[model samples]
Target: MKLYTIDTGFFKLDGGAMFGVVPKSIWQRTNPADERNLCTWATRLLLIEDGKRLTLVDTGLGDKQDDKFFGHYFRHGDATLDNSLAQHGFHRDDITDVILTHLHFDHCGGAVIREGERLLPAFKNARFWSNEKHWNWALHPNPREKASFLKENILPIEESGQLAFLKEGDLFSPNVAMRYAYGHTESMMLPQISYKGKTILYMADLLPSVGHIPLPYVMSYDVRPLTTMEERQSYWQEIVDKEYILFLEHDPVHACCTLKQTDKGIRVAETFALENI
Candidate 1:
């Protein structure tokens, strides 16, 4: 099995919201904030190539949203979904499967694109994977998360008949297994891939970055912050015990990191690019 790092670009999000109750003074040391108190984050994605099945984990914030809509997130950077795929000697259409970790715009926005007046699936030939429980949760979103779950980015997949629901125990591919984390959002699928004699767990929003390695650094965007803390506590220990490499999705500086049980607690032991593995 082969893996590729798919970098769509970077986006700015309010640092306070990103770090929840964690003080700016502490978080800023690692994720420094701008004058607007927004921190830069990468919409990094993972691409899996296992034989004929070419799967993309998550699509970054798409280009289809209007300027006014995008003004909030401040998406920037040169790496685009198409360009990144091209760099890997592949195309968007060549993708056979798109596993949406969740339906949040930053994670699934690029899954659909606007063509003329019609909104359609970006990868016309690929089957879009999302869990049934999360799909329903996104469809009927709460007041708190309504803004993040845009209909345009989501409804198109079901409309295109390319939407497929993954059950609890189903494997995305021979080397990829699906794990659910309800803390971030209901049934947010984390793809656990066994590659090169190492286990790489795709740390969706469950663990955004090395800065978030400390248990209290939960995101306010999470509907259930306490649940997030609990989930992180459990996952972090297992990750450290097994020497798992965490594939970070929103970390601006680090693509992957390993955790160590330090004197304080579990903290990032090392950070490196995916190619290093």
Candidate 2:
């Protein structure tokens, strides 16, 4: 099996909201904010190549939204979904599967593209994978999360007849398993992959960056902050005990990291590119 880091570029989010209850004084140390108090975050994705099946873990925000809509997020950077795929000698049409961690815009917006007046699946050849629980949650989004779950980003896969659901105990690939975390969003799926004699856990919104390693650094966007804390507490310990390499999606500087049981708590032990693994 082969793996590649797919960087779809960076966008800004309010640092205060990203850090939740954590003071800006602390989070700013790792993810420094701009004049607007918005922190730059990478919409980094993962590509799993196992034989003929080319699976893309998540698609970053696509270029379909209007300028007024995009003005809010301030999406910047040279990396793009198409350009990133081409760098790996692949294309969107080559993807056989697309594992959507959840239907949040930043995570799944690129799953569909706007052609003229029609919104359609971006990866026409791929089967978009999402869990049933999260699918329902995104469809009937709560007021707080409605903005993040854009109907244009979703619904198209189902409409295209390419949507698939991963059930509990189901293996996405020969070496990948689906794990669920509910705090960030309902039934957010994290893909656990066994590669090169190491285990890599894709850290979706559950753990955005190294700065969020500390127990209390949960995100305000999370519907259930307390549940997020509990989930992180458990996942961190296991990650440390088993020495799992975490594939960070939103961390701008670090693509992957390992956790160590330090005197302070489970903290980032090391950070490096996925290719180094």
**Residue 250: error of model 2 in Å?**
0.5
What would the TM-score be for candidate 1 when compared with the true structure? 0.99
Model 1: per-residue Cα lDDT over 1-277, one tens digit each: 8899999989999999999998999999999999999999999999999999999999999899999999998988988999999998999889999999999999999998998999999998999999899999999999999999999999999999999999999987778999889888899999999999999999999998888989999999999889999999999999999999999999999999999998999999999999999
Candidate 2: deviation at residue 172, Å? 1.0
Segments in model 2 whose C-alpha atoms lie over 4 Å from true places: none
TM-score of each: 0.99, 0.99
lDDT of 2 by residue, 126-240 (tens): 9999989999999999999999999999888899999999998999888999999989999999999999999999999999988899999999999999999999999999999
Model 2 TM-score is: 0.99
Q: Model 2 Cα displacement at 45 (Å)?
A: 0.5
